[model samples]
Structure formats: structure tokens, C-alpha cells
Target: MTLRVMVAYATKYGSTAEIAELVAATLRDEGIEAAAAPASRVADVRPYDAVILGSALYMGRWRRDARHFARRHRRALRERAVWVFSSGPLDPSASERDIEPVPSARRAMCRIHAREHVTFGGRLEAGAKGRMAKMILEEDRGGDFRDFDAITKWATATAGEIIALRAEL
Candidate 1:
């Protein structure tokens, strides 16, 4: 059976959406059927064999839609392979430092016993505007500090875990 995976994310200015696509690509490379889309586009979870949810963290919290989706599907998620991640916390040395993944984002991880929960410092363009983006822009140690290599590695590892788990069934 093809392992169907849903890679869903909530993004404000498209960065988190890119992250979700990376995870989906990793999953697909592992011989699983994976797809990526916005959280708002995912109508239901019952059709997928597994789910990987991620969101952009704004001001120490995940996007609202990602939170709600997890809450709505907590029961179904508990029975399948689930993973979580958050993007958006630009630290200059994130490549070496262990950035704290938000607890709110990790809530679904606990509920589903997810294979992994990852946090990647996201990028903010030079002109990050809007009230929230502007606030995040105010923080120092900031720049486009996204570690693409590390992100791919995390996605691959998570995919490997899911693939191995699928083997048991």
C-alpha cells in the first residue's frame, strides 16, 4: 500500500509553506505518496495515511489555523504517524544552537506520539512589515537565518521514521 501523507502548514508570508513542501518532498523521496498544502486547504484527515503538521511561529506561538486543525483532528491523528514543526525565529547561530520548539506546537506531538517535532529559524525579508512582522523584525540576531540543509535532514529523518513504522503494518 502506498503510504499517503499530508504535509500541511500555516504560513503568514509563504515561508512556512515552503517548509511544508520540503517535508513533503522528503516523504515522497522515501516512496510515500505525500502532498503539501495550506492548512486551510486540507478539508479532512480521514483520507490520509499519515499527517505532518507545521506552522510559522509568530511571537512565540504557532499560527491559529495549525492549532485548530490539530485540535479538530486529535483523535484521528493519535492513530497515525504524525510529526510537527515550526518555522520563524531567526537566530544567527541556529545551526549550532538547540532552539526551543514551542510547547503549543508540541501539544499535538504528545497527543499523537509524533516521530519528531522540529523548530527551524525562519527568514524575514529586509522589509518585514505589518504589526507582527515588524515586532519580530525588532528582535536582534535576526536575518534570513534559515538552515536549508538542516531542514532537509530533519525532514528526511522524520520520513525515515514514518517509513519504518509503516513497515510494521
Candidate 2:
């Protein structure tokens, strides 16, 4: 059976959206059919076998739309294989050193029983018009801190887990 996965993301200035697309592509490369869509635009999660949700973090909180998506789909997500990711850490040193997910977001993920939640470095462009992006651009450590290789690896692993879970079913 083909595993259809939805990579839903909430991005302020498109960085997280780009990451979500890359993840969908990587999952496709792993032989899983996947599509990426804005979290607010995805009205239903029942069409997919698995979900990979991500959001751009600002001040330790997920974008409001993403949080809403999680809350709206909590029931459906709990019945499927679910994974979560947070993007937005200008620090490129280690994923662990990045800021943690806000308390409420953590609680939402717990409600869905997300298999795992990974934090990836985020990108900040000087030209981004968002106030938060502009503020982040002014930081001394600012640059494109995103680790594409790591993102690909994580997506591939997620695909494997989805396939394994499918076998179990």
C-alpha cells in the first residue's frame, strides 16, 4: 500500500514552508507519497496515512495557525502516525541548544501522542519583511542556520518509521 503523508507547516516568511517542502520531497524520495501544504489551508487530515507537522517558532511559541491546526486535528492525528518539528533557531551549533517548544505546543503534541518532535535550525533573511524576521536578522549570530542535510536525514527516518508502522497495521 502506498503511504500518503501530509507535510503541513506554518511559516511567517516562507522559510518553514520551504523546509516543509524539502521534507515532503525527501519523503517522496524514500518512496512515500507526500505533499506539503500550509497548516491553515489543510482542512482535513483524514485523507493521509501519516502527518508531519512543523511550525516556525517565534519567542518560543509556534505560529498561531499551526497551533490551531494541531488543536483542530488532534483527534484524527491521534489515530495515525504523527510527527512534529519546530523550526527557528538561529544557532547552528546543535539542534538541542535551540529553544524549546512552548508549553502549550508541547501539550498539544502530547494530546496527539506524536511519535517524536524534532527541532531544526531556522533561517533568517535580512530582507524578510516580517517584524520578527527583521529582528532576528539583526542578531549577531544570524544567517541561514538551516541544516538541510539534517532535515533530509530526519525525513528519511520518519519515512522509514511510517513504513514500519504501515507493516504493523
Candidate 3:
């Protein structure tokens, strides 16, 4: 049977949602069944063999929806292969090096027994909905720093790992 994966994410201005969609698409391309959804809308994790949970970071904290999802489904998530990601670095530092998870993400990962956590570059654009975002744009710091190539690479590797686990099972 094909393994089913959920790419659930929380985003303030939709960049992280797009990343989640790409992840699901990449997994599907790798022959796995995957779908992306908002973390808040996912009422259950029982239907998925694995889950990749992601959130947009602001001020080094995860979105409230993502935090609630992790807490609300912690038990179910522990029973599945769980991975976590954060997107927030407006700079290329995420692509240049491995960035550590924020304290909240670290806590959630430990609580849910997540298999891995990754940090990815973030995007900020004009018309984004936040005072900080507006200020960033005004200061010319707003741009799409997300590296799709890196995202695809990570998703491909995640698919390989999931497939290998299935084989062993």
C-alpha cells in the first residue's frame, strides 16, 4: 500500500502554505501519497502514515495555530513518523547553514517525538498582513528568500527515508 503523508502548515501571509504544498507535491512525485492542509483544519492525524508539520516563525515563536495543533494531536502524532519545519529567516542564512529550531519548536519536537526538524528561509512581500511585515517592506527587507531547490531536496530525502522505513516494516 502507498504510504499517506500529511503536509500540514500554519502561515501568516501564505508563504509557508506554499512551501507545504510543494512538499506534498514532491512527496507525490516520489511515489508517495501526500496532501497539504492547514494545521488548524486537520482534526485528526490517524489517517496519515506520516506527517510533516510546519509553521511560520515570527519573533522566534511559532504561529499559535501550529502550537495548538501540536498540543492537540501530540498523542496521535507520536504514533506516526513526524517531521517539523520552520520558515522565518528573511535572510539566506537558512540556505547557507543549519539553523536551530526556536525554543518552542524544540519543545514541541521533543513532546511529539518528531524524527527531524528543519529551518527554511522565509518570504515577506508587499501587502502582507502585519505591522512588522509592513515595516520590513518599508525598510526594503521584504523579499522571497525561500529556496525552492532546497525545499525540494529536503522533501525528496524525506520521501526516501519514509520509503525505506516502509520497506523495513
Q: Judging by TM-score against the true structure, name the best candidate.
A: 3
Inter-residue clash pairs, candidate 3: none
Give candidate 3 misplaced runs (Cα > 4 Å).
none
Off-target runs (Cα >4 Å) in candidate 1 are: 135-142
Report per-prediction Cα RMSD to one decimal.
2.0, 1.7, 0.7
**What C-alpha lDDT do the candidate models reach, one value each?**
0.82, 0.87, 0.95
In model 1, the Cα lDDT at residue 156 comes to: 83
1 against 2, candidate with superior TM-score: 2
TM-score of each: 0.89, 0.92, 0.98
Query: Across residues 99-142, which tens digit of lDDT does each residue of candidate 1 receive?
Result: 66687777756766776777787888757778767766676434
Best by lDDT: 3
TM-score for candidate 2: 0.92
How far off is residue 162 in model 2, in Å?
Answer: 0.3
Q: Write the per-residue lDDT of candidate 2 for residues 7-103, one digit (tens) a residue.
A: 9999987889999999999999999999999999999999999999999888788899888998999999999899999888878754556455667
What lDDT, from 0 to 1, does candidate 2 have? 0.87
Clashing pairs in 1: none
